[model samples]
Target: MGIKIGCCGFPVSRKKYYGEFNVVELQNTFYDLPSIDWAENLRSEAPGDFEFTIKAWQVITHPASSPTWKKMRRKPRGDTSNYGFLKPSNENLEALRETVRVAEALKSKIIVLQTPPSLPYSRESVEWVREFFSKASDIAQGFILGWEPRGEWSKARELYDIIEEFGIVHIVDPFRATPHLGKGGVVYFRLHGIGGSEVNYRYKYTDDDLKRLHEIVSKYSVDREVYVLFNNVYMFDDAARFKRLINS
Candidate 1:
């Protein structure tokens, strides 16, 4: 009925997070996927009204060279050259399927595919994204697909076009830029914080910042679902403050 706010991951205990917020954008799914049984257990442990939105596996969006891969519990294997940047390679497609399997286990309605920040946009790169999503669509049925294209393509028309063409939600850091909603009219904000790249994780939202965020997300809430998931270091406290500010 209104803007759904939460942290990107559990900033506190799951029980506390679930009690305080109605939705969460799962970040662990990006680093390492939980086994289906684990995902099901996690889901069963949450409150009945809790909602989950998954961040697609890093193998599909980031290359083996990506530092993010170092956090994986199971090391990557095989010819990983084709992995990441949505290359539509066998490795990436397989990763997509695995992500979908976990999403299904969690009963997640949204599956977000985020491109690596180092990805450079080009004609070939654009085609690769298209090809990946094209293959991904088959496995993405019954879920709201989201794309967070970073670097040069973050706010480009090509990203918008892909979203429109494939009916995907645009995942944006609303503090940096406005999201260009496509046919579905869904708004998903990943609030990294208000600052330069270095300041993102450390920065905290002020009262004015929360007021502006509330104003921006409110515009689209009347028509479609709008999500605001905080990803900063102070996400737990910040999100709680935001909820109180808006509800008060």
Candidate 2:
């Protein structure tokens, strides 16, 4: 298995992060996009092998009421109704376009759409997301799209169909649920700790947990590249540890 290990964000300074790890998931893009010049500069600053994977802009996945907007470097200027929960509307599509522009600047290969539980597994939600993926795919050429569906969608039967139809990588926490295979050719895992079904950002992963994680990962017989990103309070340390374990 080709496992790329890193933190969800630059848990340390960008320079230090680039020195220690080759991959990072950009949470900043979800909150607000960095200037194109800045993203381009960072791309130049890093090693050529370094990779950036983005968390899609919140306007593409979140409602205005979401607390995630509180950290925005800037706020939305127009009606917020069409935004969030994969509405597949003009505003949301525009939001995705902006996200792709930033991703393009960063040389990003993956743009992840993490949806809310409110848009549970249903014929209507699946159709809406299918259309959203359809339009998003058109905008993001030569880039892999990852969808992390929350709540009931995690174990829902409808999950497999859309992923196959769109060639989307099914992003998940391996501890929470086995990721459904897709045509996207990547197994992406975002670790939020052993909180059962919910995210426990405060939890620190133990050595035994890491062992089990390695074991859990080995169960996958697929030949796809695997991305293991730690997103907890101790992400920096935990990610380093997991990287070492995998390499050993």
For each predicted model, how many residue pairs clash, with residues at least 3 apart or on different chains?
A: 0, 0
Runs of candidate 1 with Cα error greater than 4 angstroms are none
Least accurate 10 contiguous residues by lDDT in model 1: 191-200
**lDDT (C-alpha) at residue 100 in model 2:** 89
The residue pairs in collision within model 2 are none
Give the winner by TM-score.
1
Superposed model 2: Cα runs more than 4 Å off = 120-122
Clash pairs for candidate 1: none
**lDDT (Cα, tens digit) per residue for candidate 2, span 88-187:** 8998988888888899999999999998876656788778878988887798879999989888777787778888887889998888878888766688
